[model samples]
Target: MHSPTLASIPPEVLTDNILLRLPLRDLIAISACDKYLAILCNSDALWQRKLRLDYDFTVPRDRPLENVSLKTVYQRIGSPRLFVWKCEHITHPVPSHRDFCELKVDRRVVSLVATHSAFYALDDEGKLYAWGEKVHWRRLLTYKFPFGSEVLPVHIKLPTPIRAISCGSIWITAIDTFSHVWFIPDWKQAYRIVNPMLEQLSSEAQVAQVESGWRFIAILTRSGELHVVQPRSGIPNPGQNLELNGSIIWNTPLRLATMPPLPNLPAINVGEEEALSPKLVKIAASEATIIGLTDQGHVLQLSIPVAVGESILFEALECGKIQWEYLPFLSEVEKVRTDPMYSPPETEFEKMDPWTQHVTRFSRVFGRCPPPPYGFLQMPPRIVPTPPCILKISEIFISDNDICAYSTGPSSTILIGSTGMRASDRAEVFPAHQNRPVAHFARTEHTAAFLTPQGKIMGWERTARGKYADEPSMMTIPDSTKGWLFLSITAAGCHFSGLAIEWEELDADTTNAYESASEDEGDD
Candidate 1:
């Protein structure tokens, strides 16, 4: 007898054993083979299995996904996942046809963040995935992982489900569901929990968010508390001290001091201590400053001073090895006594005013030079306070040295900080024509992109002088992405990657076949 044709075999058998195992590309290609095969291949069960196997995604159990076929689910949650486009600089001799290449993430990503050197994604399962330049991956893995050399995206093992993640130039901070914060300083050190200051606040109140600066960390808790950790000194010079060269020491996380009341806000009533506490709702940080958003929608700013000239003293104090009060008493008495007639005559301690002598002793103890002689020239330390912006900002983005703020009420975008010496200069608000309510925003060193609620992306390029284009223009979405929903966009290493989703619609023939198959199954 002639062997039964493969197509004649029961559809159920082919779907369960064969089509369910096919990869996404192969399935899409074979769907055009025949009506019977197309219908079977698009079955909810077969696509669902493919999704689970390939991307580890599950249709929400609580949602009515039964009416949707697995093919539709795959299109919505799988095929349009990650789209990457390389900039002309990164991809020299650009491709003849400029287009975005799909990066198969192989998972359902819910959130993503990227830096110039690294890209990170958090999947629906709360697992962290990282991919980027091999050099960076190596530096980030250093002595921590045996497989630190991997350049492709790989699942990072963590102690718990990640709720939020933030990355700086080289370090990463992950907040788990339990509100515990884990920090990865670099590739050489193993991940460790933040100090008890963070741990205690996290336990008492849920950590609403976490953010990272080049050398600082900021955390915002549900209780309206803002905590920041920063370095006590500027970048270390290895030539001066090998032990401290390249070493990064973070200060203990400390609650930010209460902010002064907003100009128009009413004064607090007597006996209302809680009113003094700023109810911080969100926070963002730059290399040396932290910006906070209050419940009343005011923006507050604070700077973390990096000790420059007398860093050794600052380091000693930061490490708790020296106390400020003790330094005054420990000043060198012999030096003043021995140098009595060197230049200006030195006054005996008993003859000097107590307060003036105390100040002089304190300065000497901390290694700070006394005021230069009246005629001598001296440069004063540059100390510019970050003036708090009165605008009601809904989101803030800090890239390199530029600060951008988006206001929801006015639907406007403002660029703060000038390119030159005046970084805290007045902000330049974009023209009203370019203003729109931004739903998502991302930036790299020289480019910033914003996604509007209407599903449009607008981008601004920084000029050579460090100013953004006066007006932003709409970004071109690839033709292939016509029907997809853009979720988020991020830039890293001269490339912009966008997360998108597409929904598949059932054709007339496929829909009829599906209905007929349902009837046959009921009859059986």
Candidate 2:
């Protein structure tokens, strides 16, 4: 095994020369020597060198996401889903909204991390909202006393507004007032679950990544080495004076590895060999529990151990089964190979003729689709040629078709102007045409603020089932920009993929009055 004797009288060893240069699985065992050894393990210079030597680490800040907003929301439109905020003459790199379907930022951003819980969004200032709740919230609420007599408090707030947080499935790491760190279980708020009393743990620890699963927390020191600590065992009360250093209590951690890339949510795919209609195609991966970040800025994937849950090697050693396993639940879904699965089955396929519409021969990327019925589309009498200045958008809803148009931003009412249906595929496409929006509804809880050329930032709210206002919803930018106004529709699930923008000249009376007020302020 080529093991070296530590008693050989060598005063010290350079990391590259002796330790970090060793294989990662070997490094963890060796670093358990002391806190000084722990600091050495957390060295990035060592990690970077190891990364370059082993994995395809050349992503100079990987940015498949930048195709939308830049890295920081403050520096740019942090998400591809947002409209880059632009002032009259100033181009803001940061946009107020990423996607039209973006969760409305009522104010305040909080992070929630706990054992066996999916990350949740908390606006302590507003409604308790959640996204990516693949895991149940109720389970987390009763973290400490999970089962009996403990009637857990429905609402639990940290001593202070939690600015940032992270979890390790069973444990929670949070930063609060004065930047002090604290942790607890889901049941801690209901019952006070304190730390395991490890004195060796530094009081000044800063935990990061409240948004990722297998939640990671890094303790950064002024010297820059990052130390990671594991949750303690739920053993019975310890003696008054238990020495903690070299206590053999810490669980050995795994190092960062170059994992697989996540797959994209299904997008619209149509071509010669095949054609399909657009609907809700969920973008998930079989490769589950891939840790990622989501908040204000960077989306860097932090390296963490794969499934080091209860069955950890230490526990397995205490019992038997080393519980480390990869999360393969999400990545194993029976991928709908094509859209046909959503339609009817074999022999009886002809029955689907009445409900769906299929486009033939037009091969163009979304948005600026080529002048319809031109060379691209074969125009089998099944095709309809939309005029020039007009854009053929993805039908808002395949069930009831409506192509939303926009001028500036979404208005109080999106002129669902084109309600008269056309049917080449269906002889009964539109018999109940009243020549107006098939439906007139009000904008409900959804909100979007679009800046007008007149320098007015107009806020809009969507009208939907007062019922769905209670459901998880997102927003989208409207591509309805025309001459002087912008319009679009929003219901439970509308997305803003390609919203068209237009410059409008609002009435002079309002513009002049605002100008006069501005001039008065300038004189003052």
Candidate 3:
């Protein structure tokens, strides 16, 4: 029976082994063991001192914002990929850790509007989130003739555990704590917001079915078509009806008669064969392009030309430009370069091979690398490819867990940053891994900037290979990109917030910092 106190421990012990680390739970337990340990652990700055032993706060805090993890402003999403693009000059760079904000959903976000795009999620203490934005279209919610024909809206209870929501263009869909399926029309209960041009939906259009594992919800009809719907409300509305609450935003019938399975294909999965009705899906976006990843490592870039039928294998998706159709699948990274449409001007070979996205897609391409083809061309000049007519992104970038693209614009440019510097470079719409040129960024053609915590701006030159770039000079930006920022994350998992310096002089800053570090070295 003893009452221990902080006075017992020697002062020298506190400073000894400053870098030693103890398990967090064990430290808490040790503090609770007796009164003496408790006081010492609770000292003015003891916890921070102990924290420093195991963690490097300086490194973490000083990490550039642009270099943080592949997170996003909307942390509620899972696997957030940062994207930055300019129309005048293409300068999209693959974001490291600093780009993304952490998004952790209590559950997964899986909302499939059509084959082109499905929804993923992220979360920050349930305070923020961002879902997929599909093409926007309106379904007629209410169409009653003013004279006499009454258009009664079908009634449904408001959803619960839902927050904010949106729908895809060809198919209006939404997501919440639990995602839903709806054929959205422009009718309103005053409280429920619908797309203004909403078309009337069919009865079996927008019902949400709780998917297995509670990972996501499915938007399908009583028949075999799929679409996405809005999510449920996080806050519950006790006893509200349609007029008092909202009309059921549901879907219009999508009659798609695809081919049946071809003879060469293996027998259908045992599980799929047993299902009452096969869960078949096809996605279509209004104008925005979407890529679909199947469980088998298959990738399909979506367009709106329907294939013959369900009989076509997953790899056979090739057709025209429609709002909704199969996203043409790519067998090799090289295949991503071929023009899916017949337009010759639109064709460029796939040079920037995106890494495997095992988290989202089930594709055969994973772990498989293809040799260079016979006609494969070497790296070309950093000329920005002709922008797509619809302003859709022709290229996508994937670095580690992050992906980005130069999807649109009247311009083209990309910006990349390092701790001591930032660089703005032109993005060759078609950059291959081997032939990719760092010289492309030297022109500042599109003018991108990298920001830092110390209010520093680092300009960059696209170099073939070198620790320091020798050309194009540096840029300085005084104003931050404001609230929104481009984050950079390092391979070591360090994060750095980036601000665009309105004006940056590389010769001045780099020379100073370099000289200072050199002097310090000489002092030793």
Residues 1-524, candidate 2, lDDT per residue (tens digit)? 76775534242455667764665445655667777666665555455445334321211221112122111111111111212111111122223332222333333332222122232333433222333222344454332211112121233344444444444444445544334444444422211122332222234442222221233333433222233333343322334324232111223342222222332322223353122222111110001122211111111122223455643523432342321121111111122111132233344334333122222122333433334443432311121111112111111211112222211111111212112222111111111111112121212123323222221233333333211111112222335333321122222112111111233344687545644653554456
Task: Tell me how far the alpha carbon of residue 413 in candidate 1 is from the true structure, in angstroms, after superposition.
Answer: 3.4
Arrange candidates, best lDDT first: 1, 2, 3
Which runs of model 3 end up more than 4 angstroms from their true locations?
A: 1-172, 182-241, 244-284, 287-291, 300-329, 334-429, 432-524
Per-residue error (Å), model 1, residue 344: 62
CA-lDDT, candidates in order: 0.54, 0.28, 0.28
Query: Which stretch of 10 consecutive residues in model 1 shows the poorest summed lDDT?
Result: 323-332
Identify the superior model by lDDT, candidate 1 or candidate 2: 1
- Of 1 and 3, the candidate ranking higher by TM-score: 1
Q: Give the runs in model 1 whose Cα sits over 4 Å from its true position.
A: 1-75, 78-80, 87-100, 134-151, 187-190, 230-256, 265-278, 308-391, 418-424, 462-482, 503-524
Highest TM-score against the true fold, candidate: 1
Encode model 3's per-residue lDDT on 1-524: one tens digit a residue.
67864454474474243212444344445677877666655553454344233221112232333222211111212222232221121222432222232222333222111111222221222222232222223322221112112212222124433332333323333433333323222222213233322222223233322121011122333333433222222212324333423433322222222322211212223455433332333221223233332222222333322332332312233222122222222212222333332123333333222222221133454545555546543443233333222222223322212222322122322212111111122122222211212111111222223333332333443333322222223221122342233223111011111212112223676545644653554456
Model 1 backbone overlap count? 1
lDDT of 1 by residue, 332-396 (tens): 22221222222332346534543456557878798774654555333222222222223344566
Which 10-residue window in model 2 sums to the lowest lDDT? 279-288
TM-score per candidate:
0.55, 0.26, 0.30
